[model samples]
Target chain A: MNTAAALSIGVFLFTYALIISERVHRTVAALFGAAVIVALKVVPWERLPEYLDLGTLLLLISMMIIVNIAKESGLFEYLAIKTAKLAKGSPMRVLILFSVVTAVVSSVLDNVTTVLLLTPMLLYITRLMGVNPVPYLLAEIFASNIGGTATLIGDPPNIMIASAAKLSFLEFLSNMGPIAAVDLVLTVGIIYLAYRGSITVSEGERRGIEAAIENLDENEVIRDRELFRKSVAVILGVIAFFFIHDRLELPPAVVAMAGASVLLIWSGVEPTEVLEKVEWTAIFFFAGLFIIVGALVETGVIDGVAQWLLGYVSDTGQALVIVTWFSAVASAIVDNIPLTAAMIPLIKAMGSSMNVYPLWWALSLGACLGGNGTAIGASANVVVIGIADREGIRITFLDFLKVGAVIMVLTVAAGMGILWLRYVGV
Target chain B: MSIFRSLIDRKFRSIAGDRYDEIVKRYREFLLLPEEFVLPEVESILIPLDRFSGDFHGVLDVLEAYRGAKVRLVYLLDAQTFRLIEETLGEEEAQKLLQVERERGKRLVEALKESLEGFGLEVQAEERFGDKGDDVIEMASEYDLLVISRSFGSEVTKTSPISPVVLKVVQHVLVPVIVY
Candidate 1:
């Protein structure tokens, strides 16, 4: 490698080490890396904008604003409470319904938000039922990753994949949805089986809890009828546009921003308040990441890495397996967002020389599913664990791994098989 | 395409240029109350509605002990629970619950007021939406003393004697807490 390549590679490794070590905030680490790259003139300062993925940033901001508005309108809590009511105090039903609901919501809104909305209400219901909420919380986390794996906008990794691969919303659904649906069912079932005999609520207690829930006025949850209607309308309109954005020759970012604008106009919520709710830390982190990754692309380091991987794979099936397992395992160790960001360029470089369409699906499945391996594997897991900790329910890494590791392995293995059959064999 | 690029480009630059920690700190500061308001003198006692057993008349013994101390009755509908209900049921239902909770608080206040008529103690009723523990803590600073009964909603129950929230409130607040 030449001087620029060596320097670029060194900076990239240093950034990754800092991020993985948790020594400094990720945003800080990423910013330092990006600043170093720019200062070194690896990519000219004027070309900084060219390097950043504007599409991804815009989509994230717009989505954040939309979700924040929905949150303010209390849409998420409404859904979770409605789903909890369906359980009617049965421990087994609570686990199943909550897991399924979490997964489905994660598919639409993002896993972290889903967990944030669900955990408190789930705990409340579980407490009322006189059951430990640990199992229910864990199942929700697992289901979130599984459910988010199915769609383009569900998980950060999938969003990165869509932006990088130019994949459409429908394409993501067609490729990964069926397998993710199956994984969610299996996940809920596994969680139920593991905790079924442990929950010892008596028939009398169950009936008592059920009666308490029946007395709860569900309609009392709505804080504002007009805002809820408006928020729901905007969200539904955004979803509809996501389906046909390609046909309209509109970018996903455009559709998202337009939806956000319409909501702002309709709701009359202050722009600053909406902007304050945006996850600027993640956005900034992504900006720095894109710069670093762009440096790698400019230096041909990604191509080198891609060539190294391609040399090992004899056929498409082996490539699919390797990518899926590699991504899954890597994602378990590090957060899937940055992992996906770094891998996108390499995957693209690999695809240029051969038909590697299946690899995208494999990467999506692995990165998202792998997030269930440990408490820190994904944003959703970490947030859920944090909430549990704050609420005086401690979940250690080993405690999470005992459940998460099993689910991660099973789901990833199944994902590889699905990719092999659907993409490669077909 | 260029206009879109420039617009996004401006955003990306700003995102990179901005300090997240500083922004978050500013936002946190913005969220805090502008300035602390001076609390009223500690001549009254504060009690949560649910803490009283057998409705408002349940605190008769404590009222008899205090003699001339005024009473402030607070009935809380958990803000988190209220928001959850509001989202699921609609505004109409949420309003009804608020009305119901308020009505319940008023009745409790009235009963206490009737019982304490000869004692020359003032009676006040309030319906709040939030964590009862937090509401109690915030109110504790202003009260001379808090007379409360341990209830099911308390984090520290008979089983878990040192409840997380109640204990924290006791530790943080300057006022004395008398648990019945």
Candidate 2:
């Protein structure tokens, strides 16, 4: 290997270690790695923008801003209360309804944000009904990952794939949406059956909880009705634009940015206030990762790996399975964002020798769904688990893995089957 | 006294010119009058209760010490708990939960008032939302004595340390306190 390739690989592996070990903040580790690469001239400073993938960054930032502003309007809380009330205090019904809402919301928003907004309220409702929240929380975690798989912008990995592969929103929805829907239903059903005994409440307690929920006023949760109306209108408009952005010859990033800008002005919210809430750490982490991964691409390390993989597995269907299962297991061990970041270039390099379109679907399915395999597998899992811990409800790593590993295997297998039928035709 | 001291200090500053600060420092204790300390004649009593506090009946014997003292029963709806909810959920959900807690606090205070009044003591009740320790300390100044349970701020077992809120009130409040 050349000096630059060795240096790039060293920096990338070291940074990946730091991120997974959480010895230092992931953002700091990534930025430090990116800095080392640029300082050493592994990837020239001038070409940094080339690897940054401005579309993915912009899309992430815009969605964050939109979600932050929308959250202030009390829309998410309103939806949660409304859903809980709709369940009418039935633990099984509540579990199913919340899981479905979490999936649909996570598909539209990001999984971490969706869970952060929903879990506390879910805890409150379950506590009121005198049922365990662990099963519900687990179901939502699986549902969020599954739901986030359905759209181009649903999960960070999917967003990165769409940006790199130049796949349109409609393509992602049509390809991954069906499998995600199926997985969500199956995961929710499995969770309900597995934890039904724990979630079950007596008839008297159910009736009392029903009365309590009935007394809750969903409308009272809306802090600003006008802002709520504007946010909903803009979000709906954004979704509509996402569907037809391809026809309009616009990228998903542009659609998202336009929506975010319009909402900022239309809502009359201070720019700094909304901007302050943006997850800059995640954004910078992505920027640094792009540069780090770009170094591997520039040094031809990825190309060598791709060549080796192609020589080892000449059959396209077998390659699809390898990529899918590998992405799933690897994502389960580390943050999917970095895992997907490293894989994007390798997959692109392999595309030259064979049809790699199905590889993209496999990567998305494996990386996104694989996050459910462990407690530390995804940002959403860590966030929900942390929230649960703070409330004195311990969801140990083993407890999560027992359920998460099974769901990850099931969902990834389902995704693999769908990909095989769609692209492999067998 | 403060106003009079300020006038005297100004006059002294004019006479002593730049030497005023040095003179005040040398005789600071004499210059600043010492506050008079007197035994508190307990007439009005402030009792702060959280949901986990022991029943008022457990403290009735203590209350009988200050016979005919007006009792103010204040139920504290802990702001910290609601803030945690807000941090995890959104502000709207926290507000809704706070409102529910406030209503529950009101009901608790009202029930306690009726029972306390039955003992031939005047009783007034109010519900407040704030940090339990800070609120108890702040409210204790209005009454001659503070009556709080050892489990005022949090649930405790016999082996647990005294409640932090009760400890804080004991340390800071100028009024006499009865920690039952």
lDDT leader: 2
The ten-residue window of minimal lDDT in model 2 chain A covers A382-391
Q: How many residue pairs clash in each candidate?
A: 11, 0
Q: Mind giving the per-residue lDDT tens digits that candidate 2 earns over A1-426?
A: 999999999999999999887678788999999999999999988888899999999999999999989988879878888898999989998998999899989989989778877786788777777677899889988989999999998999999999999999999999999999889888987787778789888898788888877866778778799999999999999999999999999999999999999999999999998998787878999999999999999999999999998898897798899999999999998889999999999999998888999999999999999999998787777767766665777787788989999899998998899899999996
lDDT of 2 at A90: 91
Per-residue lDDT value at A148 in model 1: 93
**lDDT for each residue of candidate 1 in A358-423, tens digit (9 for 90 to 100):** 889989998999989987787777766766665677777788899899889988887777778876
> Candidate 1 chain A — worst ten consecutive residues by lDDT sum?
A214-223
TM-score (all chains, Cα) for each model: 0.73, 0.74
Error of 1 at A123 (Å): 0.6
**B1-180, model 1: which lDDT tens digit per residue?**
344233323332333233223322322331222122234345778776543223444556656766677778777667886788889998889989888877766776677667776566777777777786778889877888776655524545467765455566677777767665
C-alpha positional error of residue A149 in candidate 1 after TM-score superposition, expressed in Å: 1.0
lDDT (Cα atoms) of all candidates against the true structure: 0.78, 0.85
Q: Candidate 2: which pairs clash?
A: none
Question: fnat, candidate 1?
Answer: 0.00
Candidate with maximal DockQ: 1
